[model samples]
Target: MYLQHPDDPEKGEVSESDSIIRTYQTYNKPYELQPEDIISLRIASLTPAEFDFVKQYEEQLGIIRKLNQYNQGTQDGGNQNNMRMQGMGAVGEEGSGLMPIMLDRQQTGFTIDRKGNLELPEIGEVQLSGLSIREAEELIKSKLINYFETPVVRIQLLSFHFTVLGEVNNEGRYTSFDPETNVIDAITLAENLTDFADRSRLKVVRFSGSEAQVYYVNTLREDLVSQKGFYLQPNDLIVVPALRARQSRRYLLPATTNIIGVTASALSLILIILNQTQ
Candidate 1:
């Protein structure tokens, strides 16, 4: 558990110049591409001779943008309907009815092969296993240098998703395009933490190569913002465990009450039989 620093009311009137504050540096590292990661690749020409190719690429991008807009509209309508159902007490679970809507609105992107390679138009099978987005763009640019004069390459990770499980209102996988997404953002996507959530024992699980690393985060503290695990990566898993009190109330108390009720009923029946014999 994490505690906040106590604020003194009597000593609060300090000048800004006299106050001392400590700051911690946060890691803003770029994400490396991995197997099964979906990405969008675009190669633009700097010269006029290849303008036709650029036009074709732009048209394709326009079509994708339109499709994404339509999907977003559909998702919004679904969310509104779900909310209405919830308010009417028709929906039982928090995220139960939204999965199909989310799946239907998913955007298709190019998936990286198991061998750590990506096959692109004109440039086939480029090894992008351990490279960052910028490095991969440079590699693609170099490959197209002989064919075109100074090809401008742009690569964006399209499938940026993370999972939130346990004590959240909406526990499921969420996708976003923001590179600077943090734990708070991920939780917000899952409709924030539930009332029974244990904030002090939140867990973030990340996988690197063949090993998985788990990091404990204390959401109640201010120092969590400076922690490296504060910012979430693609495919990160956030687990918010339920509080002990909630578990006892939801499961233990009911079982104990049922046993007591049965015992009382049995004792009453035996007393009734004794009275009849008398």
Candidate 2:
């Protein structure tokens, strides 16, 4: 599992990159629901047409996503993981002839207000703040039990997003369906860093209560895996500045190419004139 440098067969370095590793201080803690968070909640019932919007929403969202991919003309994106932490497994008609239900629709989700409560269309207002995804699903399923016999509930945090800016092919906000995202994952979602990106200056900003904490990382260093900045928190902002010294090269590259082209053209013209005069 190693690749030797082509010019020097004895040299091997990048082969170590075969595996990516990262560690987080909050690795064990699941992301808790916060005010202004958006969640998609769906339930399964015995009634055939019951809670059909969940399935329809998923279908519509798929269409819109496909159209977006087509319009953007780029296929590079992080895989949107389906986080089924609990409740309902598959679409089966085991004995009741009912399909497992889910919450999704044209990407529309219930937003938790400033009070940390979601005013769901079906279940009314429910306080979901400070609750993890698993906890929220459990609570919602418990409530659905009063309505449907053998009810199944599914939820997705549609508002889980992060922003990647500077020194990347695609610089913008990206939705993360999975909460366990790391530095490499975020950069990949941004289509990886550009050639001018400074690997030693990867800056990550995390907003804590009333304050912002910044972490710096050097991707070229092997110790980065153990660094606190290795793992990206929800809503983290990643800014990768261009190589400090080589940044000028980004603009100089075109000018250098033009100079070379002009010099080559002049040389060709001089050779032609000499041949004609001789």
Write model 2 residue lDDT over 62-93, tens digit each, in one string: 56654553434334432234211223344663
Worst 10 residues of 2 by lDDT: 77-86
Candidate 2 regions exceeding 4 Å error are: 1-28, 45-48, 51-107, 221-226, 247-278
lDDT, candidate 2, equals: 0.71
On lDDT, the candidate that comes out on top is 1
At residue 56, candidate 1 shows an lDDT of 59
Give the best candidate by TM-score: 1
TM-score, prediction 2? 0.59
Measured against the true structure, the TM-scores of the candidates, in listed sequence, are 0.70, 0.59
Per-residue lDDT tens digits for candidate 1, residues 122-150, read 55689997999999989988988876777
Output the lDDT of residue 83, model 1: 22
Clashing pairs in 2: 57-105
